[model samples]
Target: MDPKPVNHAAWINSLGMSFAEVPVGTGSILVAREETQERHLALFRRSRNQPFSHAARPATQVSWTEAVAFCDWLTQRERAAGGLSFRQRYRLPSDHEWSCAAGIGHLESATRRPEEKSNRLPGHYPWGRAWPPPQDAGNLCGEESAGDFPDNFIAGYQDAWSGGEVHARASGPNPYGLYDLGGNVWEWCQDRYREDKDWRVLRGGSWKSARRETLLTSHRTHDPENYRSDSVGFRCVLAEE
Candidate 1:
C-alpha cells in the first residue's frame, strides 16, 4: 500500500514539527523543516548567545538531552490534548531511520544495477549528487564562512549568507519533500555514537561545514549527549502504528 502525505498546515500549525511522510511504511514521519528559533522559544529555550537576531532562523546549539526532553514534553502534551492516540508517540529518529529519510540507501538503484537493492537504506544530499551544491542547496558555510574558516570552507561558493547572518530553514523542499537534509545545522540522531554510548550521532552537516565531504548525506559525527553548540540541533519523528 502507498503511504499518505502529511497535512502540512496541520503539523506546522499544531506541533511546529512540520512533518514530511517518508516514502516507506504507512507514511513514517520526518520533520520536513528544522525547528526554528521562534518555534523553540515557545518551548522556553534559547539558542547560543540568545537574541542575536530575529527568531526565524533554525534553532541551534541545543544539547541532545534537551532535544530528547522536547520530544518527551511534546508527546505528553499531545496525548493530554487527545491529539495522539496511545499507540502514537513522538521521538527522535534512529540512525537508520535518519538515513532512510535522507534517501542514502537507495542512491544507485535508479540505474537498475542488480546489486542496487530497491530496499536499500539511506541516501544523500537533499539536492542529489551534483558537486558545488546548486544554489539553494542548503545553508552550508559559504564565502562568508570562508572569511572566518577559510581553510575549510568550500571554494567558489557564495550562498548569500553574510559572515554574521543567522541561518534559517530552506525556502523549499528536497526531492523527498524534506528540507535541509544536506546542510544547515547538524541534526541529532537517536543512536549512541560509540560503544561507550557517551555521545550521540549527528547527521546532516551544519552551516559551518565547508567541504563536500562533510556535507555528504551519509556523513556523520558525534558529540557528548550534554554538549551543545551553535551548529547542533535536532528534529523529532512520529511513527504511526
Candidate 2:
C-alpha cells in the first residue's frame, strides 16, 4: 500500500493559508493566512496565550477572542496571497456550513418537527439524535484519520474519553475527505464567539468527551470571551466561492 502524501504547502494553499508550527498560540498549530494582511487588519483578535495549558482544556492556553479573529484573518490572507476575489470573501464556517461539508444535512432536515417551524432545521446535536444507535455513521473527532473505524461512525464522539493531545493521532476521518475531525479536539467556529457576550457556539466534540451529544454536529457550548479550555482547538475553512 502506498503512503499518504505530506503536502503542508498544498493543504495550506488550498485553504488560502500559511502555517507556523510553534508556540501554541491558537491552542494548536499557529497559522497565518491572507486575511491578516489583506484587510490591513489583525489576523487573530485575541491570539493571547493563556498562562495555564492542559490536554483537556487547550483554550486556556489560547485566548478566546483570538480564535474568532483567525477566521477573518485567514480569509483576507487567502485573497491577498491566493489571488482570490476579495469581493467574493472569506470567513469562518458556520454550524450549517460545517454540517454541509461533513455530510450531516439530513439530520437537520429530520429535526424540523411538524409542531415546530416548518422548513427549519433541527438546532440540536449535529445528527439530531441524542444517542446514535449502533451501525450508524457520524464523523471524525479532531485528528483521527478517516476510515480508521468504518463501523464506528455513528457510535458517537471520537475521543469519548481521553483526547488526542496526549496522543497526537487517532483513527479514521470523514466523508469530506478530512481526517481527525471526529474526536481529536473541539474546533472553533466562525460565528461571533457567542450570541451575546457570555458565550459562543462550539461544534464538533473533542476526543476526551464521553457524551455522544457533544459529538453531534448541532451540539453547542456556552463559550465565553477570554475563557479557554483544553479540549478547544480550531481549524480554518476557505470558501471555494
Candidate 3:
C-alpha cells in the first residue's frame, strides 16, 4: 500500500492554524487553540499573506456567522487542491463532539436533554476535579482581570496570567492534545443555544471570564449568532474519509 498520505494537521500551520487530532473513529476532531487572526485576515479581508508572528493571537470579537464562513473557505480551498475527498469537509464541532474532544465523558443520548445542560460530569473541571485551577489550568478571569470585569472574576484563584489577555498553545494540551479547551477563549460549537437554532452555544471559559466554574468541561453558555465579544473565539473540525 502507498505510504499514508501526509497528515495535513501536521503541516497546515502555513495557514496560521495549529490543529490537534482527536482520537475519534474515522475522522479526528481537529481543534485549533484559538481562531487564527492571520487566517481570518487573509481569507476574509483579502489581505496578502504575511510571516507568522507570535503577536498574531486568537481572532476574537467575531460573530458565529463569520466563523462558519471561515470553515467554508477552508473547505473549498482544500477541495480545490484535491487535498480533501468529497466525503471530507471542515466545520464546527457539534456540542457533543466538542465535549468528547475536550475530555468530557459521553452523553446518554445523541441529542441534548434539558437535564444535560452541561457536558462535564459531577465535580469535573478541565484540569480535573480540582476546585481552584492550578498554576496554569488554561486562561480565565484571575488576578489580571480584577481591574476590568471585576464582577466576573473568581476570587482567591490565580491562573498566573496577569496580562489579562488570551494566550496561545504554550499553556499545554489536554489528554487529547487539544489546547485552550478549558480557557483562553469561549469556543463556539455547532449546537444551538436552545432547542431552536436561533442562538449558538459556546464552551470553554475565556480570558475575561470571572467564574472559575465556567472553565469546567461541562460549563456551557449561549450567544446570538451576530454577537461578538473580546472573550469569544472558535476552532474547526474536519471529517476524514
Off by over 4 Å in 2: 1-60, 109-169, 192-197
Decide which is better by lDDT, 2 or 3: 3
* Ranked by TM-score, top first: 3, 1, 2
Per-residue lDDT for 1-241 in model 2, tens only?
A: 2112222332345423443221111222222221122122222332334233222222323334665565556566667786556654444455544444444544454233222222233434433334542222232332232244343343333333222342232433333334334444565555544344555555556545445555555555546656666556555555545
lDDT of 1 at 188: 88
lDDT of 3: 0.67
Per-residue lDDT over 1-241 for candidate 3, one digit per residue giving the tens place of the 0 to 100 score: 2112224344254365666666443445566545555444454545224333335667677678877887777787778888777787778888877776766535324466422666435667766677667666767777667776767776767776755466676256666566777777788877887776568889878777656456667887889998898878888887653
Q: Tell me the tens digit of each residue's lDDT in model 1 across 1-241.
A: 2123344442552535566657543345655455445455454343233444346677777889877876777777788988888787777887767766766533433223212222233324556656777787877787767768868777666677755454555524654566777677788887776756677888888778876657767677888999988877777788665
Kindly indicate the candidate among 2 and 3 with the higher TM-score.
Answer: 3
Scored by lDDT, the top model is 3
Off by over 4 Å in 1: 1-10, 25-27, 44-54, 107-124
Off by over 4 Å in 3: 1-14, 25-27, 33-35, 38-41, 47-55, 113-115, 160-164
lDDT per prediction? Answer: 0.65, 0.41, 0.67
Candidate 3 displacement at residue 72 in angstroms: 0.3
In candidate 1 the C-alpha lDDT for residue 209 amounts to 83
